[model samples]
Target chain A: MTVTSSVPGAVPPPSTEVGPRIEPRIALSIRDLTKRYGSVAAIDRLSLDIASGEFLSLLGPSGSGKSTILMAIAGFVDPDGGDILLDGQPVGGLPPEKRGFGVVFQGYALFPHMTVRGNIAYPLKLRGIRGAELDRRVERAIDLVHLQAFAARMPRQLSGGQQQRVALARALVFDPAVVLLDEPLSALDKKLRAELQFELKSLHQRLGTTFVNVTHDQEEAMTMSDRIVILRDGRVQQTGTPDALYNTPATRFVADFLGRANFLDGVAGSVSGGCLTIDIDGASVRHRLRDGEPRMGRTALLALRPERLSVLAPDAAVGDRNRVEGRVVTSAFVGSQHIHVVETPLGVLEAHTPAFGAGVLRKPGEAVALAWPWDGGVLVEDR
Target chain B: MAKRPLSGEPYVGFLLPATLLVCGLFLIPIGQLVALSFGGLEAPTLRWYEQVAATDSIHRILLTTFRIVGLTTVIAVVLGYAVAYAMAHMGERQRLALLLCVLVPFWLSVLVRALAWLILLRNNGIVNEALLGSGLIAAPLPLVRNELGVVIGMVHYLVPYAVFPIFATMRGLDGRLMMAARSVGASPFRTFTDVYLPLTLPALFGAGLLVFVFGLGFFVTPAILGGGRVVMLSEYVSISVLQTLRWGLAAALSVVLLVATLALIAIVSRVTGVRRMLGAS
Candidate 1:
């Protein structure tokens, strides 16, 4: 029963990727956390270390235990086992209020009865700060969210984005040790979400407060997080920078979740010159192995991104790229890219090209060749 | 109905039935009551109103009515708030059970509930007998036969009125607000005062006003529980009509009670409705 929750791709690559250049002080650490509801476990034995002032995102689909992990860190959920530490001190005995970690709920839960000014002053007043100091702090907090003029308005009177800003201001007013956001931007329109993504990122930069965010939106996680920990069934599939996860996903799930992917099944061949040559449907393919040793003689799975493949005339110069001949089965123009579906001997493959410089759209049944670089694909664990 | 009306202006005939019913059933009767309070439709007089303003017993009765109704409103609202909070947070089964606890008694006849309280609260009743058996009192306490019994009966009858409105508002509130408050350095008690209590205040006041108006018109409970000693405004108005045959005085008291209730409704709706209970749902 526990085998389903185990991570087969737990072995990460050599951890020498140059991330943030700071001292990398550890701010929060989760150790062997486990939470179960009756017979089923929402979160398994998960461990994570967050750096000081780092914007870390727990990325996973619904019921993958991403929200449970965030709730545990915020002290809204009590784990059945293991411990949570804040700044290297165990905080298992603390409640949510005493934990000193601010949380922005998913729906922006603003106090409807209070004005914007009153909502922002709530935390300060609870801390026993009053009079001139309280007023000055509340003013600063409201100004930080750019909502000073609307301070007298009730929460329902404001727009959704304005209400979100007030919620954020209320959380950060007391200078919490850490801030947890549970899908903060999920309630906004797409354009507003994109705007606030950068706005929130810059806010984190200016404050230098450690932020732990939980989101199922891969684009949102990639846009705002300094590091991403992709979870599958309550276990970490991979934890790396956004660029690393996008380029070299450790599992088939991560690759498929992050972006469009083409999984090619092939048998592993001999390794030579830092390349692993494999045979796919009687055609040879080559992939540059980074640091991990190749799985020799066993069936291998290669994750090929669609944009890395290019369509060519059947008689064009192949150069050093791996080429396969096929017929154009479908063609489309999707805003910025011209997508072509080519049926080859191996399978139906796709190629995306820049829409502006892309010549003419390939018609159906046109003979074409698809070529990809040797290093464009990565070896991902099928598990 | 179509999306738009057939004409730009309202039909005007659509309001005929309800308007006619109101004018026939309500306005005409109220006009007659007002006309009777002055001597008659033909010859108007202020004698009954003058008598009311000058009499000491009328003043005492008005004061007594306000005091009893005010006390009943406060107790019922507080108890209702507590019950509503529990209903809002408890499990589904428990919440349904508690709702039945409020609703079943609400559906019971007001006379039946008043008598039930009499049976439990009277001297040598279950409460006094139990206390006597436990040696907690030397003699049977005067639990009924006065203002205390009247208040007890009225509060019991009015609690369901207070619970429904408050509970409906509580159900609409987002539970995340409580969590958000705690996440922002507010303890449980502080979160209640700072967030929960303030958010539900409009509903509280609304329920209080509803209870007060209903308590103002109460007659059966006070008549039975007051043991003929604690006569409220409603009971006095009854006496004026049935016992003394003073229809003019009865008509004047009825006008005063109705006007007072309407004035209170207007004032409360003004104060609590200023914000329109903005975002109350």
Candidate 2:
């Protein structure tokens, strides 16, 4: 499947268009990190290297150890058997204060007793900054987040979005080596969260500080990150750019977690010229083996994204596409797209089609042919 | 109810019992004391007030009372803040155990606790014996029957009061603020001074006010531990009434104490807002 804009015309151009590729320098390296709580490993021997000035996100579901990894990097949670290195220096023994990384907590964690200016001025003041220089830096930080007008207000006096901006300003004011965000936008409403997601991406581009965000929202991770790390059960499932992960997921969990996927269980019949022939419910299915080595006579699973499958009229030309006859069981109009659940010989398959003007939508119980290219299916390891 | 109002305002009847109780038990006695302080209701005069103002001993006693109360409040609040901070950061079982340790003195009577301290601090008591036995001093120290004994007893009594408000404030504090501060490059010491200490100020002030007000009216501990030497306001009032038969002077002193305490509470509430001063906010 290709990386098509999920919300067409609603999102701006992708962030990659603004800059050419630059050589990446390693900023922070987490080596062989392990943490356990009474025999249950929260982070089990995880290692990752974050490049300088790159926006990376640790994305996973609850209990997937994403937050634990973020905490370990932020020096809040001590790892049992690993070292965190900042700029090639081992900082595992350093306290969080000595680590000198900015962190934006989930709840915005702004000081309630302090005004916005005071909150933003805190880290600078701790560094013994005072007078005009401090004021200028604090003002610039507040201006960075567009919170100039609300600088005099207390945290409780501001709205949630405003509080989030204050938190952002406070975190960025110190100009640390990296900024760690723990689901910073998760507490916001949907509309505000989307707005901040766009703003955070733009801010990262403007500042060019290494940002490591932890979130369970797949769309959020995809929209704001330069690379996404998918984790499950204290282990790294896949780490790649959002497009790469979406188009070519390495495992069933990565495919299922990143977006919707339809799994077809089949037995491989033969392999010829890099193409694997499989039998699915007495029907011959062909899948192009891209980076996988599937063995013959073994059961295999193919992950087909719903958007890659198209529903056609019963008598439509198949034309070298993988076709299956199915009866439409349910169809839903989701404004921008139509989702149809079709009962087929292989099992139930979900298909998504863009909702254009006055298109023919198949009704329930109608016989329909679902067609997709052979390359649309990716061989994914079963979890 | 004679046809309750339809506006949904709080019913005055619900407050009637508490109001009657306060007026009967608190206001009337204070009113009587004020009236009696002015040379009784028959010929109300400011003779006792003038006499109290003229007496050097009354002035000295008032100064002594202020000193003891101020010292006790500072000592109790500082000690209580440490205990409360420790309790706030302890694990659940440890916090509960520390809380019990703080509160056990309350289970015993104030006079009993004062007597216990007397046994420990008297010249011939265990503390002096230990010190003398250890060659830490040439003679048995004068640890009791003075200002030191009274302060020790009062601070012990006031600490639990100080702990409750400060602990409440500490518990209400969001600990993540400290983490955020540390992440932003503030050292642990700086974080405490910059974030934690300022956030817990309201609790400290509230606890200080509580301890100070309670110490102002203390009688039992001072009477037991002072050994008739440190003449605080309460003991002086009792001496005037019981031994000297100066009922007017005693009444005057009581009126002054009541007025001073109320004025202090009013000023504190005005400064910090009563809800915050009580650590309720």
- Across A109-171, the per-residue lDDT of candidate 1 in tens digits comes to 998878999989988988899999999999988888899889999998998899999999998
Superposed on all Cα atoms, model 1 deviates from the true structure by an RMSD in Å of 3.8
Listed in order, each prediction's TM-score against the native is: 0.91, 0.90
Q: Write the per-residue lDDT of candidate 1 for residues B157-226, one digit (tens) a residue.
A: 9998898888888888888999988888889998899888987888898899989999999999999899
Candidate 1 matches the true fold with a TM-score of 0.91
Candidate 2 per-residue lDDT, tens place, A237-335, comes to 777788888987767888899999999989887878677887998987788777544442488888999999989998999886799999999998888
Model 2's alpha-carbon lDDT is: 0.87
| All candidates: DockQ | 0.77, 0.77
For candidate 2, what is the DockQ-based docking class? medium
